[model samples]
Target: MTSYFNDVAVWQPHDLAYFKRLKAYGSRGVVVKSSQGGYGGTPYINSVGKLQVINAKRAGLKVALYHYGTFNSLRYGQADPASEAKLMANTAKAWGLGKDTLMVLDAEDSSLRTKASADAALFFNELKRQGFHSFDIYGPGSWFWAGRLKIGTSYKLGGWPASYGSSSSGVSGAKAWQYTDNWKGLGVDGSLDYGGQYTTKSAEPEQKPEPKLTKQNVDDYYYTYNPKRVIVKRTIYQHKNNQLGSQANRGRKLKPGTAIDIASVHFSSDKVPVPYFKLANGTYITANRWFVNNAYYELSNLKTIKVIKPTYLYRDLHRTKVVKRSGFKSNKWPKGTLFDVKKVIHWQGGFVLKLTNGFYCTAYKKYVKKIK
Candidate 1:
């Protein structure tokens, strides 16, 4: 008598009906493909992974997720493993998957035969950093048989090697064994959850929220002179070097309004020294004042603004649709006018200071000077 579970990829039907059917067929749990490398788009991430995760949980089946590793990709190289691991953890959190949900790495590329263990350690370590507790590595049983894949005691890493054999799992020390591609005529991969590894649960500590900044504490922010974090002011690409050119945009472009943690700063050796912020994730972005905002005054203590230039009020945060003059006496506020700030609305890398009069004005420092 063997207790088993089903593993599914995008190839399987993702409807709630299908998962209900699997539950009816005596499956207690399911491993759903969730995401892949940095791209994590379309088929790389199971197109219906979010739906499948929701449905699987609704159908009363314990759910797990797996990321298809692409560390061997030529463009991304070794960085892909950590990036993909972060993608997996973030994607799972976005889908409301509990941290206890088993996160497995599907490593099947032949190129990994030489460095499988190293890549696995890198992937699992990143996952742990993101607060994921339970982990497993899945690949062909032959890789495990040949000692290409190995788990260490540094973390609670488990193996889920697959080999379609009748009686044995082919490899030893597996936490779970995928013993069949088609289990019980269902035409889906099935595995035996040895030692209840797939059913056990753990709790993750809740993360604390960032502190709110105000005018009183503004001086504390600048006392250090060096910023520990920065907000992107424009769409910018990451680079491996601090050189100034489009050719050096080697990594992905971060969207405006994204906050990045800084690891350290490096000045380029070019004719005009350019400062670059090294991200905590080992990527680099320009510390240029035109591209990113590092000072706390840019956001904190924005109580009110004195209109120094011709300013128009907007009905929305984007300021695309101007506020009509019919409601107010005029559509434009003259220079030297003061607007009482109700609250500041942080838009994409910019601020829209919502006035107490029920209209929004741009918080660009050049256009308006802070009065309060």
Candidate 2:
């Protein structure tokens, strides 16, 4: 009788209840795909990896993570393996994986076969340098048999090779042998654990101490939240505090150019001069100067503006040239003439409103009455 553990990638079904059922069916542990090749110069993190890890733990299964290696591909091979390893390690740490978690490198790509050992050595070495110790390399048994990926003698890392049809994995010194693609009709890859990483439990990483809170300095701000409306200018995460670190939650992606209503601003002593915005929904987002624009927030809030007093339209913010023939019957907008506000620009000591016709006018309450 062969004891088997399950391993999954994006292709596998990830229902939490299903994992509970796998545990009930006598499976002891599982390996989950955590990342892939670098995307846009960073590791391509699996969207469901965190969810899978959580569910597996809830199901009482001893769990670990693996990265689908592509550093050997023609497109990504030019990159240093250390960079990819660091990105992967950082991502895993961000996901709350423990330092002792078994991190496996799935180096099955034929393009990697020739240099698998050297590159895997470098990749695992960087992971080790980053405080991750337990590691393994998984691939076809023939790759090891042909001397394509000899495990480094200096490192405690082991191999996990797949050799389906046989009772034993042909590769010598393999930590585990993947024996079947479908175990007990579960429709997932099954590996026979050899009493190593797959069976050993990993401890969670230590949590950092929370930082002290303080009122945001006025000098640290460029644009103040006037109407409680904010617009995201760059993708950012929601954090529990103003201090930025791995604790920033990546589950919710505050995308660029998104206009959102904020409840208020939170001040913190994060060493960096940025304040945090408390959203209407009670989530905290960084008010990083480079990541948000309050100008758009003001613009989107003003649906229309009414002329409370006579005003002349200027071609630009300079307010120097007011044409004699304005679009209306006169050069000035008459009192009570209503128009939609298209843009808002902060000018000297005040804000300016732009009309749909590319004309600018003072946004002062005396000149224009804002209509929500």
Candidate 3:
């Protein structure tokens, strides 16, 4: 399917009306990036803009948040090694995004080569570690031709390709190919110029069958844990616009001792929209930050916590395994059945739960519940 991003920052008053129309018509998903500023300049959107876009997504629009990556010179300052990592991490958390959301790293600038590829790899690895699965590295085709960066494995390519063959060649298994830096269509402002178009086919047509829900399916879905109550010593840092390292401040180091409860533990599945926990002190936290100690905990003993708020879950459309219930009908499962944990597989769509009884499933916001 064709995906359209309104590029809201580019819209004027009249253009805004057209933007809404486009959303109602052709747009399947939107990537809300910073807009061009005054006098025909690019606009810079903040967290508020992101929140607004997410709200729009809740209203049936598939929305994603975008950043120009570390390469944007004028917007994020020069490539500062010290600020880049922290900026990426803080941005991931601030966006409230996990693996499901698109993290576009606009790398169209020529300045990125100044930094060593090793440094870029380090930055990309950290972004992966911070729970971002999808990455869009936008740049010209020469960057791919000359630099010889592992395009398909490292990230999805965006930007204008030198030729149609180059666009179809597939960089780092590009999910979408942006054809031109400038694409003008009917009713758009001033010949809209940016990325081209998606080279890959839409993922919608190849969806897999939903797995049957069973006790085995539920129990196998995630790992369980009982964490010891201890203070996780972490250093929080402030990120500069385009830097990779954290700046040194007098109290930059968090206190060596701060008591926080480990609370309940569950498996960290790429397939599930992890629950956000509000600490006793009102501090909200993401499930992605919860680290699993495989050596100590058994998947069965840990308590499974049910998600309290509404969230989205991504089920892999490719995995198809039929489950056989003891007395239930061939296609249906009884509620409250507990299954054994089998294996967790990470696929392009999301994580998949493979059960001992032969079922593959994904978790959605309201559909999951922990067995007491």
Candidate 4:
């Protein structure tokens, strides 16, 4: 089963009954905010911080601590890093917290030379040097996405940054989520932890690493995660980049009947990155433009057929309306050009072949035949 931890601050008081209720509701962890700035240029535990831990432990919950982060640059006067670390260390000791108890840095202010990640690295490095283990960083969703904080992999737990009353778009790279405040009438922030991210009654068990898919190992990713694929319409050019300007420089027109795996799809976006699918060989097609101009064949299947003679391509499934029939018949293809047809469907009196490009053509056996 899964477990959860709620990061509580001074604003939230210690209620033993509430703690017991949370335990009854399957919460096994509580992360109390233990420090703030201005305690002799160092931060100390919050007013009810230690007491909250005691109450949570009494109510049978594992307790961790987080601190409101501030750096030397943000301080108006003398900022002593060593003294601040000493004070926090003393508070951590006073509360009997350690690696198993998880210390988190809550950094919202981007005051480190306007570089949140850099400042985070600086502050977290100091904490590490001071012999603190099991660190974490908490901030808004954008803070993690814009990647301002250089939060190395050493930190395990990640808390969601969504505040009260705002909808969370998504949680990217976050193992744990702080989805909302005012959770279920308790007025405490609610969270969801994935895997064994939040601890249970036992120590963390060892885990195996999951394999990643890169260009070098795309075959593995494709074969492992293959889903329903798509068939191309008449024709669409695959571009190196989905952006229009870049497409001009790097567009390679692909024929109909080519299958492409869905890389990603979005109904709308500011930037439509990864609109199409990548080929099994790791080639990619951009879906930014063309809607894209691809369509599916019968059962989304593609089969190759050789043109033994010239054939007139039709504009629609009824082959009588030949493409450019009156004006030089530009759509006609010579014998050498092979057509990848989904099937030669029986249409009208004469048969019309269903092309992968979502068009139809005459399927006279003498003129064309399916190849093995």
Candidate 5:
């Protein structure tokens, strides 16, 4: 099971450190895809080239060069067929990579479904015909051979990281797998790369013992004690702290549908910088960013509530109100009486809930209802 790290044009500044660490973790090979510069010249191969040089300087390192068939159509038109071949040829020559280095064609854009497939097939076949033994193919699981083009044995697979558990089963004759499109440990500015036999290990264990918490639990609290719980769903991205706004704190993005066990919740007068939860395995991570009501629920019960209302703030002190209503509200409750939470707003010491109907109210801890 050979693993290939395939991020060429999307390389972030900190990818160098990530590559080094990946190698330390037992990766056998690294492949970089080249991207065009901000000013738009031949995609700058300098960073990737330098990394290759550095890896070559080290012992027992394998590095490959890859180029995307086409960048975002919005930014760069479908990669010119002639230009694509030239990019591969030039990068190989510049990096002094011989037949030992792998050359990959990552083709996953829906816009170039047919054209890109043909181009990639031609490019890789040409490389193989010229005696390039390590040539490969890559793309998101969905887009690979979308046009039904026959992928010759000369090419291998470079799948997106998120597609691992789901689509990896369908991949055949793939010499390498590009498991993740992003790695947050590299920071928002950096991306983690994985390849070689090291990537075959499961990065993290699945969350177990699902929580039975439901909308009834939330509504029971509102009616019995007037407090409500908010539920937020977070997806993991490759860059852990990439979307975080404040420099003072860091967080992790959850895999699109990965379940997490929420340990605890906290509220503050100021915005809470989401904390990054390190996984037992150094590879995967979790972040506690979503805040509901005033309490933070652990990943255990958190997964039960899919729809959460935002926290709303109210200035009027006289009227006692119930802010945001959860979607899991009791189906037995009257329609107008149930208020949905839309957004979360900070107030006093903790946070306030914004009801779906546009009302604001405060939830006291005593009002929390826990229903099995």
Candidate 6:
């Protein structure tokens, strides 16, 4: 069977935004540092580290913890694996980590002289005895090297090897691969979990429900800067540009009342005889239909204002388009009609307003008073 890896983003205190910004990316799981050794008995979890673990759970990602272990008499001549394991277990227990959660002991210390693999077994044995059910061993490429830390398969321990820019972890039955330390501009080790110790079972942020388009007009968000501003009216069967001339696939099908974004307008070919809107993703949505330019929507906040006097409210400030919903080509609002203004500005030789409900008309600033 061919082995595959599942993505799981990891972060350390130094390389760090922590895990709070995880929603911005699609990492399915995260492994955070629980604590570290070499500082004596009572290991302290940095506030940032604690927050990363907690936030990973809130973001619906499977969370795990790892600890950087120390050298022992068998490895480098100093640092006890037994002492380190006990401290690691005690720290996690106090932090309230469930025994079911995967814990990892980083066994990649390079200064070991001999018997490193035996020391690793001792560490794992201690963790298992301390009640960590799904713990694993994490080491660099050197641990599996001939004379360095020779990991034993008899222990039946799962491995997460730090193999940077390489195609393989070089360790048999490895659970995950620490593929790289720097990915997507983050200064942290990244891994691909192989489902031995961790699984990508959670709701990812990218799979959102598509909006329904039921009428000739509907309002939905389009990306301007943050997918929250710059509303535009989109119509059905609008062609996406890059898909336009491709033999492999035709342009994307756009349904009537479907809301789409315009990255920018393009008229690449005059011979084509139409304009197209560049989508936020660099693709294109066509403006082949004339009515597309007239989709009803608002680009700003809606504000209520008091109409001081009865005035003719044209659908357009220039009286070009009338609000047919009012049953009048040109409607009139009596004194004291409360209207929400989407846009208040100066028009041709007069003041005009765009209504929140998608009516464009002109009204004098003095004749209409802003409520707040």
Best prediction by lDDT: 1
Q: List candidate 3 stretches off by more than 4 Å.
A: 1-19, 34-48, 55-59, 70-82, 114-118, 154-173, 180-372
Flag regions of model 5 displaced more than 4 Å: 1-10, 13-18, 35-48, 56-59, 71-79, 110-115, 125-131, 145-150, 153-169, 182-184, 187-372
**Residue lDDT tens for model 5, 282-311:** 322323333213243221221111123333
- lDDT for each residue of candidate 6 in 213-307, tens digit (9 for 90 to 100): 32322223222111211223333333434455454544555533455545565554434223445667666654433224322222234377777
lDDT of each: 0.73, 0.73, 0.41, 0.59, 0.42, 0.56
What is candidate 6's local distance difference test score? 0.56
- Residue-wise C-alpha lDDT for candidate 1, range 332-355, written one tens digit per residue: 877898988888765654456888
TM-score of each: 0.51, 0.51, 0.38, 0.48, 0.40, 0.46
| Per-residue lDDT over 291-352 for candidate 4, one digit per residue giving the tens place of the 0 to 100 score | 23222222224377787778788767856776664555466777877878877564432356
> Which regions of candidate 4 are displaced past 4 Å?
38-44, 72-83, 110-113, 150-159, 163-169, 201-372
Candidate 3 or 6, higher TM-score?
A: 6
lDDT of 2: 0.73
Model 3 agreement with the true structure over 1-372: per-residue lDDT tens digits? 435443433342222444455556555445555321211233244545545565555545555545544433344443342245446445546666555555555454444554334344554565667676655554445555656343544444343223233335344444454443333454431111133232122222233344443444543322322222333233222122212122432222323233344444433233642322233433332222222112112234323323343222222336444444556444444344454535555445234444555555543213345453
Q: Name the 10 consecutive residues with the lowest summed lDDT in model 4.
A: 289-298
> For residue 305, what is the lDDT in candidate 2?
83
Could you tell me the TM-score of candidate 2?
0.51
Per model, state how many residue pairs clash. Answer: 0, 0, 38, 7, 39, 3
User: Clashes in model 4: which pairs?
Assistant: 34-45, 117-148, 117-149, 160-178, 233-294, 233-295, 233-357
